[model samples]
Target: MKPQLANRVHTLTPSTTLAITAKAKDLKEQGIDVIGLGAGEPDYNTPQNILDAALKSMNEGKTKYTPAGGLPALKKAVIDKLQRDQELSYEPSEILVGIGAKHVLYTFFQVFLNELDEVIIPIPYWVSYPEQVKLAGGVPVYIEGTAKQQYKITAQQIKSAITDKTRAIILNSPSNPSGMIYSETELQEIALVCKEANIWIISDEIYEKLIYGDAQHVSIAQVSDDAKERTIIINGVSKSHSMTGWRIGYAAGNKQIIKAMTDLASHSTSNPATTSQYAAIEAYTGTQDAVEEMRAAFESRLEIIFPKVTAIPGFKVLKPQGAFYLLPDVSEAARMTGYVSVDAFVEAILTEANVAVIPGSGFGAPSTIRLSYATSLDLLEAAVARIDSFVRSKWQEDLL
Candidate 1:
């Protein structure tokens, strides 16, 4: 007889974004002209200076393992960055680096959560948040953020969701899936709630440098000292520097938590890649012109694509303030085309229109679909046209 798998492993859902991207690649490899908008990484190449730094590190035999938490220089760099960018101060002892932001988050949940601890997560969150909580033996309590509010939940909603079991709340600004940023006032209110409840706040600021238009990114930890004491900041060079494959991300907060995470990392990943650490050092302390250049590119793409996407019949989208995704409500389109569900509509688009987008059901927003604008402008335009044509054709068929 076959051995039974662990319940935790059995119940885990594979990442929907990766699954769809893989399917799109399969179709492309089979000679189909598939345009995939499922990936979350920037399309831009890693900056040349960052690349040169990694090469230099390797040539100098810096490939040997460093501290499990991170190199002293990298941790110091992270500390300097937090101070400079967010106006927040941190000691090196309060920093912990991991394979990536995702790993840092996972390690955090493992170190902090007890069995049945509840983590309040806003809906339309990154696909991994709830699953990561579950993997840590924690229960996820979801609060829905209405479209009218730009998909940001109110502090009152957070207060209502709190219970004795509530351990932490995950806040993602310039959020994944929706690309909605929380205003300073909204964050101050939420921070007040967290401070009163003494709930830990896990602020994922991976897209901090990608704000567009007049929108500004604020760190929850910067709201007040109490909030800073209770909040852990997670960030990386992945989105800002186009270094997704570099596998370097860091966490900053209470030294006790950082120490625990470092101890955990000591047993697990050992350290982020040595060369990647060197590359990240340059990414942080080197020139930042490339960061703004990429942000402008994304903003330019958004300007061109947002209108085109909304013009499609039965689709509605809010202009994103940051990040590279657009969550468009497609329930009307699904119903108009005689489809029963958004997932079916998404699959049909992949199969018929040859355009890949992640279904919103996976992100707890079933009436919508998430499209990444992290591809070239030409490809985005073509994908939008294909989706427009596909929906129009289905609408016409329904008329018959």
Candidate 2:
């Protein structure tokens, strides 16, 4: 008989974005022309200075294990970054650095949750949020954020979702998938709700540095001292520095919780790679010119391709305020093209048009599809044009 896997593994859904990206890669291996719009990482190489920093650390023999939480210098760099960017103060004891923002968040859920405890997740969430909660033996309670609200949940919705089992709520501004940022006023209101309920707030701020136009990134912890006590700010250098492969992310919050996460990390993974931590320190402390340059490139691509995405026969997209993705509701396009579901439409696009986009079903927004503009302008433009042409041709065939 086959060995039984843990129940936890069964509940976890494989990341649809990764799956689609792998499929696109397989086709490319076969020498097919494929434009993949499914990437979540920036296409740019790591900045030269950060690369040099990593090499220097290794050459200087800083290649051993750091403290399970992080190196003191790296933690100081993170503290300085928080103070400089958000005016939030933190100490080394209150910070826990893990492999990446994703892994840091996983460690957090593992430390924070108890079996059957509830975590209130907003709809259109990052795919890993609910899964991580489940892995930590927490129940996921979802609240929907409509298109009219720009995919952001209101404070009242959060209050209504709270129950006796409620342990925490996740707030992702400059959010993944939708890229909608919560305003300072909105965060203050939500902070009030969490404070009243006495539950934790997991503020995912990995994309905080990528804001464009009039949008601003605000940490829930910045609302007030009480809010700061109740909020854990999750952030890292991956998105900001184009250092996704370096795998350095961190959390800052109540010292007790941070300690608990750090303890867990010590057993599961001894430390974040020492070299990556050095790279991250440089990421935070170095000149930020490359960071801004990458942001400008993404904003430029968004401006150029967003209109083309909207021009598709039945696609409805909200212009993203930050981050690199566009979550467009393509249900009408799917229906007009004779597909019963958006997932099927995404598959058809990959198979027929050789364009890979993620189905939003993985994000709890099944009617939509996610397109990442993290690649070059030529590729993004070509991908959108292919999608538009595919939809138009299918719609015309249906009419005939």
Candidate 3:
């Protein structure tokens, strides 16, 4: 046979974060003083408490395969966290562990979706949602949420996107690119729509602990009893414990769905790294101090970033109620400059301004780009200054 790729492989687009990270790496290797805002990683080191626990596990020879679903202790820890943090209840059998929340989400589709089934994703979502759906032979139907909506979608938009074949909906609070946190009222309304339609809510709460302000993250499961049964809660230690590379994540839901996911994961990853599982156990069971400290720092940066970025003539920023990211409507900047897309603007800024932010196109929104403030306050202040200067200098008043 001539050169060929599987249909699934052919349809897969390389991960946007990986692509951006690779480009940044290459530039850095070549000695470019690149400031990378493209990565989705947390800057904080994995908590020492968690790290110490993993090292102890290794010393105790906990490096072998555990259960396909996960180790009992870790699963129980996750369950405990849900109960303690969000006031949600789940049994061990209802929880399924995988390599990370992304894996949990990907395997969710792989286990549940069939050819031509649809996944409803709010646009400007995490970059992986559409692709993961596609890999599972599902179509991703994106519904755009504009800056006017604070980059948050309404129940009506979700309802309009549904079809009889729509198998699931992905909801991310403290969303990656926009950093927009859904209010309890908004989630309750969306939960009602999805519950009536029997749509699966794959709630991504990986950033649950990263949220700022008095706004709370109401897991659809926490909305009410009916909503709880219809939800698969996606969570991990990556953001909460700054353990991104430790590669442990899990989800909880109705046991039938959890069983299917475990079956799929059994043959695929088998189990997450045993050491990572031990580390994650500590993450859930350990102190809340590290997480609180990080949130405070992010809140501090948000205050600094909002005023400075918005001061730029074409930039429109909605003070994000949560998450460490800010997605300013830079569509106006594109018009005033010669750049036709956020991708082009990102490239220009990196080349001329030496600052890197992910293009909105990657997050399924072309009018906005994601600027992460997950770094030091000084760097965030400096990056925004450079971005402000670059956009202002290129302002030609729609000349392009």
Candidate 4:
């Protein structure tokens, strides 16, 4: 059916995260005891007040469609959040809310990208970049950042990748699959390059408040005047406030792009849910306590998980600065098991050890595997031990 589908659709694959999740579920239903580390959601429940706000909205008959741009209050809240948190200012008209960060991005690519308009994508990117570019009829120029640099590309790398056809560059921080956050200094370098080239930046800061330790999450728009004008800042409460299922996300940007996306969203889903909008209002306007509390827990997990994984034979882990996932280089671990490489190692671990992880190939970086410590510390500790033994007993004894 997919082969007979639209040419653009056929060119893309199913989402890597969801695919691994489905595989894990199939194993679980078959009575396998799998500790799934492949999920991206926070383990915490949505804070009680935020949930109560949604329930109250429903009781008030707020279930109807909202304006495509968003309810006046939610859009205004998005505006306030940008100014308050990112130190970037925008008119309420410049805000557009949608289903999630994913929707905001997909619609932006569809609306503005034309045939062969190149989008500069940093490699080891979130898995959806190339697929979305293809769907939007744009070319994705991927620039690979090696593991040595903590999977972050430099200003020189960006300068090298641009061409006249390049339209925008996607930037995700407190990055998924890597948890690498760009420092203020690092973002300044990239911003200077983009300003020199007059390039647009799609800054994905969905994990804005989930950073661990000393990681400072800086919005590219906040770097300078030029960056703020050309950048579309994507943010949401999915990670920060534990609101993934509520499906609220937004973009604060230049008026023109915001208008185009609002128009596109007007016909597609109309608006994000009314109750979700109300819930998001609480998410943004509520106390700062929940944000800090969640960050503390995630930091603790990172403190515990990274050392153990790196101690395993053939394992290489770059300390993740933000987000909740650590990408452990498992190339040698794979060879030790006699299965050629990582994909095999991942399969064996999932089936035999009942531990589910995402293969690095899914994230555009083979030989490295992604492990999310967003679950209980007990599960994380147990998962790493099982993996270490599986590798050391079967392969490298001395490293363990």
Candidate 4, residues 288-389, lDDT tens digits: the string is 788889889989888888889889988988998888899988887788666677887888888778888998887788888899988999999998988888
Number of colliding residue pairs in model 3 = 0
lDDT of 4: 0.87
TM-scores, all candidates, are 0.98, 0.98, 0.96, 0.96
Question: Which parts of model 4 are misplaced by more than 4 Å?
Answer: 1-3, 14-16, 396-400
lDDT of 1 by residue, 241-321 (tens): 999999999999999999999999999988899999999999999999999999999999999999999999999899999
Better of 2 and 3 by lDDT: 2
Whole-model lDDT, model 2 = 0.93
For each candidate in turn, give its C-alpha RMSD to the true structure in angstroms. 1.3, 1.3, 1.6, 1.9
Q: Is candidate 2 or 4 superior in TM-score?
A: 2
lDDT of each: 0.94, 0.93, 0.86, 0.87
What is the per-residue lDDT of model 2 for residues 267-363, given as tens digits with 9 covering 90 to 100?
9999999999999999999999999999999998888888999899899999999999999999999998999899899989998999999999999
Residue 356's lDDT in candidate 2: 96
Return the lDDT, model 4, position 95: 91
Find the 10 residues in a row with the least total lDDT in model 1.
391-400
In order of lDDT, best first, we have 1, 2, 4, 3
- Angstrom error at residue 132, model 3: 0.8
